[model samples]
Target: MKRISSIFCVALIGCLLQGCEKKIDLELKTTTPIIVVDGRVTNSSSEGSVVALSYTKTVKSDNSIVPLTGATVTIQEGNGTVYSLPEVSNGVYRNASLTGIVGKTYHLTVVANGQTLTSSSTMPTMVAFDSLVAEDFPGFGKTIKVVTPFYNDPPGYGNQYNLSIIKNGKLIKDVFAYDDLFIDGKKATFPLIYSRKADEFKKGDLIEVVMNCIDHANYKYWFSFSQSSTGSPQAVPDNPISNINGRAIGVFGAVTFQKRSIVIQ
Candidate 1:
């Protein structure tokens, strides 16, 4: 098992990048319907987890972190236990004594003004690596369309991921997926893509891919990060969800969400 992991996903963007119009019609202002509070835990270990909460910027506004000054955040454990989390800092809640143990269930709730938002699921055991294979797209082998396939044991959510291409143990290129997305009101985890970034990888090299997943807020931030990253677009798979199990619920981040992970293949 690798010491760390990463998740891959996409976010719903409002404003256009480079002033180019894209998804401009899908605008959800603060007064529209819901407020999405993305809470994903990345950089975690047996020691502790540092989770983050983020939101898509207000439509037509610059990319800025929304101030969650008075918002109340709470986490619920399995067996219907509840604990209120004080804001450790801006948009962050730290449970110094709380550690994410595999197999135990957890739920998060954030209340602001007169609104309440919640989601929950159990954590999965850590996943091990598979392999990263590089192949050229049909009719485009030595040129334009080179495809890199990253596979891992238990090819699904809750498992962590990161990609590394090494030359003589020297770092060549690495990619990490931010696997936090609202699929049917649950948190989803997936793999990352990094073929186009490095110009020096081939079929005989050791190319490793990393993967993992976190909460919705972390998912959205990573989604935005990927969109704003300086490279070609790599899209992550979205989970199937209902109104009750969505990340972006009524006037909140999302409604229905499954935090658990499973094997895909």
Candidate 2:
């Protein structure tokens, strides 16, 4: 019986050793997305003061931004001041319309699940608009190539234009669609980017763009209409776009897209 007991102990030790070796062979690590919070205090910001927060996307695929369902963001200012931002939407936080002054120091804190993070940037002297301009977006094998220069789009609040593409009063459909660009300079030309599309228009398609200013909120309303994929143009009927005349606090680069009808070599 004693000999049998010894054999049983040896079997148990062998099993324990094998389990330890398997665990030693296994290796694991993790990578967590970085969370970012940006706060801006502008002099003439319509909403007063606001905060925009974002998170890192998936490294391999373009569609991966983790949702901010239960994230909490808070801002604290100098002089022992603390403010709670309202979660306007998923991951978007807004602050009360407080006039932000120059030289005031502010900091932001973010907490999601158990992870915590922080970031801060002082508000620079505010810059106002000169006017938003739309010009021909060159490059990217656009319609008529570089020879056809895009002109300044007239000012309007919304996206409708009382304009015509006339080469000698003949209406031409040179305008393809809106395309935004991030120039090498890294500034978002921040314009309603557009360009002539290949095949959509002919060579030397003389096109003219015209529009008057509508409302400051026209772009947002029009975008929603576009997303619905409505075949018709009127996105928001109430904000009927009329005159296309206005200037911008700054210039905007136009957007462009490749005309599928025209094939490239």
Best candidate, lDDT-wise? 1
Give candidate 2 misplaced runs (Cα > 4 Å).
1-33, 36-39, 52-57, 143-265
Regions of candidate 1 where Cα sits further than 4 Å from its true position: 1-34, 41-51, 54-61, 129-210, 213-265
Q: How does each model score on lDDT?
A: 0.39, 0.34
TM-score of every model versus the real structure: 0.45, 0.40
Residues 1-265, candidate 1: write the lDDT tens digits: 0112222232232222213211122243543432434353322543233234445444333434454556777776677656666777876665655555556667767766666656654555554333333453433245332324333344344332223333434543333333422232233323223454344444455443324433333333333333332221111112212111233421111111112212121
For candidate 1, the per-residue lDDT at 255 reads: 17
Worst 10 residues of 2 by lDDT: 248-257
lDDT of 2 by residue, 20-63 (tens): 21111101121344333334443334444555544433222232
**Per-candidate clashes, comma-separated:** 51, 31
